[model samples]
Target chain A: MKQTPRIASLPPAFGSWRDIRPLVAVVSARYRTLLQYRAAAFAGFATQLFWGAIRLMILAAFFAAATEPQPMNLTEVVAYVWLGQALLGMLPWNVDADFRQQIRDGTVAYDLLRPLDLYSYWYGRTLGFRVAAPTLRGIPMVLFAMVLLPLAGLGDWALIPPASAVAFAGFVGSLVLAAMLATAVTLLAHISLLWTISGVGVDRILTVLVTIFSGLVVPLPLFPDWLQPFLNWQPFRGLADVPYRIYSGNIPPAEIVPELVFILVWTVALVLLGRLILLRGVRRMVVQGG
Target chain B: MPQIEVRGLAKTFRVAERLPGLAGAFRGLFHRRMRDVHALDGIDFDIERGELVGYIGPNGAGKSTTIKILAGILNPTSGTCRVDGLTPWRDRRRHVSRIGVVFGQRTQLWWDLPVIESFDLLRDIYRVPPATYRDNRDRLIALMDLEPLLDVPVRQLSLGQRMRSDLAAALLHGPSLLFLDEPTIGLDAVSKLAIRDFVRELNRDRQVTVLLTTHDMDDIEALCDRVMVIGNGRILADGSVDGLRRRVRNERVLVVDYDSASEAAMLAAEGEGVRLVERDASRVRIAFDPERLPAATLIGKLLAQGTPHDLFIEHPPIEQTVAELYAEHDMRER
Candidate 1:
């Protein structure tokens, strides 16, 4: 065979610089694809806005009935609710519909033929989805809540700025870490499609679990005093509740490092666990046919 | 070493058996029944570099299973397969980086993206250098006439156009071995011919080894120098197209247009081992085993019997030959 001189002459193993190019490309390509759906973004924003208002009302009613010295004051509770609504896109509650379709239709065989690492490829792609969904829909919903809450006589329940420069940095750090952790969780759910053959059940289960344990439906601090420690110890809390708590200055300055460490540990553990599961799933798929 | 090699390569899938009714389904959940389907059973083959080999079989005859294993997407249950001295399943990343695969029924391109964008993404995925990527991309676009379709999203292109773009996408990395699984399926005649011509040229000029699996007999006849007929999870025949034709049935049909129906009938009965398979007004079709009687002798006998206005010799349809081959091996039952 006549080999292409340039290709044959190139080094067999990719350099460090070359290795990261495809990962970056995958993330950017996924982000661009999400941006192309203007109408979908608009619909998503509107839906989240409506849900944010409903959640806010429910929180307001509960706070009104509570006695003084509640675990979270009305303002902190309001911010937490709005943050949950905003970061709803970051929760890995749903697997990528395209990926699920590929699995169902058997086109995932093409994925196996590619040169990239399957886990890393999916992780990068899901990271883009997690980041893009929030940037497109959640930010608008958050901004809407900031203006709508105070006008309803909700005790100036607008978003409270971070307490310090260090706190602001911590908020950003936690949010990024949370996104990575959510991607790992989503990877695990997506890989389950290999055996389950359908993602609907997995998606529904993940949704309920995330809604309850991630503090999306209600703040973890308000999940009854007895259940607080259990909820905080779970990995689901690291996805959204920890980041929101960090952003709302709920974690005191002294304990911020430990909480951040706690989130990091969960993120690393979930990622490793996801990678291991994906390897086994891929081996089964290649050997046994999915 | 051969460019592609398979020795005792086999793949078995454990298929869960399902019951017929609701009660059986419930019982099945508690006590599942599993059956092993041997998709590929101890198949062996080798193709030298730069060879265009046709791997053909009836549906469920393990053609696709063999292709999947060779392409590095599926692992065989036992034995060994090496492509360019690399074990595909063990060294997948490096193995796949050197080969290209196209499945006619499924596309690898991003559906919502422009054709050019998918090509660019493939380039990045394969880590093709910028200069070489551009060179191959431009050459393929021109060769496949894909320039006009470059800006269109994949979902918008017609099947033929989409296939052309897919061909270009698969070759953008300058792979030395290309595995095409029904690449011309569902294409119009013009598109099919164009794709066949392009593949022929690619294999001839670039010396790229091609392993094509297609139900299209024309594709096999037009491109393959060697054809492998697989059936019942095993190879039944392997040789040139004409060699296969001779092995299956050494028969030739002679169609004679006579001046009168009586003359056609008289000629049909005059020859030995020549059976009249069909007879229409003033036209008669006679089937004769070429091994028993040469075509020239049969023509001479027809002339001796009566004067026919016109006559020509034709081989039995290749499809029928292949079908008989399949039945002889009990491919359907297996």
Candidate 2:
């Protein structure tokens, strides 16, 4: 007699991956959706470039005062600011208001039914956006920064490749770490919905804190010595400022290896914490107003 | 062994009780009160493989809670439940792989993507084999007549079209068990009929185990071979549709029109549990138990007594029957 394999006998781990598949599915869908609005995407890219040029002009003026014949130079300042802004755009910030909206709108009911861990789904989706951000925001900024840098007469193009590779790896790792921490924070905040009617204020405050402390607006080295210690230890620094330092060569290659190791450690810790928070939050879900 | 087994399934929710009005709302922020709600209390049932069961209940009667527990969305406070030999809450990922759930209020379809794109995504989600997926996808699309709507974005689809697409998407994985929660809640008559017919065919032809919860009696009457009624955190009744109907089978109504009240000779038909309502000089309505007096004999006796114009017999409406049963069990006040 011939018999087909029973589903029960199949590996259980296969089921977990099957559920995670939708995360990729959703990202691909989002990409196709963004393609339909390519004109808007390009317009966004142009706006980012304009902003980068403004920041470069100010940094160049500062460089003129600092040293004879440009101390920091145009290329370094422009590339540094350009990558910083692009990395800022790619960092994990989707959970700021999205989780609150989902809880309020009752759409979260569908999300709960999915077989995959909800946090992983959000992580994978954020990865897609980060990948997409480089194309839409980073590439254009790099081109504009290159064009604007010749005033300093210092194009050390040879330093670009290794620096870019290290920076890319660090940025991706940092984004993963940021996303994990952000997801965990949001999960805890989302549980507040059970206690509070709204989480908008809390969400806004968290975003503002991330922007200020993560060195997205200003460089971390510019902060006071006392605050520098705090930034180095916190997960936010790895998410944004640490990667920006590597990209601008503020931190040498010898310094980056340890930073990468630290970022990896933060990523693993935050993901585990996020999973635990999600487990606790789901058990306490009140399912308001059907 | 039963394909689905539930023993003493109970779920209690701690709901934050909010006071009404502006002043109360302000006070609630500082000092809040929580009330425990027993959504499901001691529910037990067994469904064999290939059984099409209708789980009907009134609003907040734990219909959704039971469905969620069985689908592995929420864990019960206590008790045991297994779907296809796996504890749903413990082995959720693996258990869910064998089941397909469709919430009519929600769309599993990607709103911005075309219907076919959503199907492709689900194929990846369930990890359906390429060949098996092709066969199933083609068959479902054809069965649901979704070829014309394939390329249209889900946001542009009508409720009927989207529902048809949702059904197709859920089935792409070829799950052995299917959970449909209010699958026909707010559909036009045509769409409702299409959904009901497809569900019937899915159960009958595919031998799939179906557990459907609905407020619509027609959905219950049309699809389910066995029906379970839930009320106030408990299973009120579980039986075949005929058996449920028999539970509250006391009243039979008959409408009769006569030539004239005087010619009907006082129209004093009494005894053997008959209550006459409305003597409008021409027509008379009687309520009685058909078991005690057969309709044919009663009508013949009525005709012998008076010259009739028309007569019709009707069993009580399903809603009234259920309401009465609920009241009998003291489920309405609670």
Candidate 3:
């Protein structure tokens, strides 16, 4: 019998560069598929705008009546709130709808046929899912809050510029890690779908936790002083609380490295957790029905 | 060494039995009941390179369990199995890279992407060299008539079209071994024939070793040189399709349609190993061992009684043959 030559001239394990091909392909494919939903981004922007208005009103009323000094002035608080609303898609509160369907149809097992490691495959692809929707909606929201608000004579209520050149650079670098942190959390939630039925239970819990702890619901500084230490120590803070504060100069340039280190540790930890669960899940997945 | 080999392979799954009703569910949450299903109970087989084989069984049988274990996606609880000299689950990344698998019940193509884009994605996924990928891809597209469907999104494809694209996706990497579980499950006759033609040519021309499991008897008869019948997690019979048929007590079914009801009534009785199966107003279906009461002799006697409008003899359907095999083996119920 004639033998076909080995199709993979570059084995994945041996060639470091060749291994990135699958990751890049997966991310690009997902990114292109998601960016097509322009209508959804528009609708999401409107919804965020309405909520941002209500949040700003509540904060202004509270700040005007305050008897004591606050950590962030109204200007800083407004910037933090607007940034959180704009980058809300980067919070990783929802599981990819694909995970639930894949598990139900037993395609998750079929996905194992590929040469790539399953956890890394999902982790890399999640970067696109985490970014594209936010990019579409975030740009519009930033324009409305930063530029349009000033022209409309609401300059005091507008999202302020970054504190300095150093702060802007730190914010840019930290934002990249924020996306990575969000991807890790998203992959963890996706892998959890293999264990749970509807995936709504864990998904809903993560939404509330992420919104509360990450300061997406309210800036972390506004939380009662007793809750500050717990919020500071948790992993969810990297999603919004830390980066947004850095951007508004609440966290100074000198502290950016330590803050970035905190986000990095969380991303590594969550990714490792996702990898362990995925490996164990596939091993015993009997996959009921056809 | 053979291209695929297994010895004393086994996999056991522990399923948690959920009780009925809200109250039962609440109690069950505290004290759970677990059942151990031995999906693959020490079954074993081997296939040399270039061999096309079929694995067939009823719905809860171990055919899929075995395929998954061999594909390296699911781990076996005990025993050893190897494909191309690598223990599948242990060396999964490399092992899976060299093999192609298609589960007939589900598609691996991205649902929202056009068929051609999905193919391109697979090329990058497997890192196939551009020249080899284009050569093999063009060949597959022509062989399967996929040019028209290339631009259509996968969700819009018919079952047969999706299956063809899936088959192409699996092969773009030029895998030497292919595993297909129920490839013809829901396909129409024309589609089934198309798939069979593609599979046969793939094995013959490319010498790609194939291990396919299906409930379709025609797929087994038309393609596999060897057939393995599984029942209750064991290999009940493994040989030629004819051997499996011979093992059944009754080898063929003869159906006769008479011009009048009296003729149908007259032929309701059987002789020796022959047994009458079913009869309607003007038709009589009989099961018999052709070796004892040859189909010709049986027909001759029927013709002597009266001229029949029509009659035909066929080997009993594979499902009946397999069910009888399970009964003969006396395998335990799940």
- Write down the C-alpha DockQ for each prediction: 0.38, 0.27, 0.33
* lDDT, candidate 2, A89-161, per-residue tens: 5554434344466667766656655566556665554445445655676666666555544445545321233
- Residue lDDT tens for model 3, A93-209: 997776677776666777778898676677767887888878888999999999999999999989999999888998998999999999988888887777785788988998998
Q: Which pairs of residues have clashing backbones in candidate 3?
A: none
Worst 10 residues of 1 chain A by lDDT: A1-10
Look at candidate 3 and tell me the lDDT of residue A159.
92
Per-candidate TM-score against the hidden true structure: 0.90, 0.83, 0.85
Off by over 4 Å in 1: A1-19, A146-155, A252-257, B257-311
Clashing pairs in 1: none
- Please, what are the lDDT tens digits per residue for candidate 2 over residues B15-105? 7788999988999999889999999888999999999999987788899889888887677888998788898867777888789999898
Ranking by TM-score: 1, 3, 2
* DockQ computed for model 1 against the true two-chain complex using alpha carbons: 0.38
lDDT of 1 by residue, A123-206 (tens): 777888777888887777766766655677754667766667777788888888788888888888988898897899999999
Which wins on lDDT, candidate 1 or candidate 2?
1
TM-score of chain B of 2: 0.89
Docking quality tier of model 3? acceptable
Error of 1 at B40 (Å): 1.7
Candidates in order: C-alpha RMSD to true structure: 5.1, 6.1, 5.8
Query: Which prediction has more favorable DockQ, 1 or 3?
Result: 1
lDDT of 3 at A220: 89
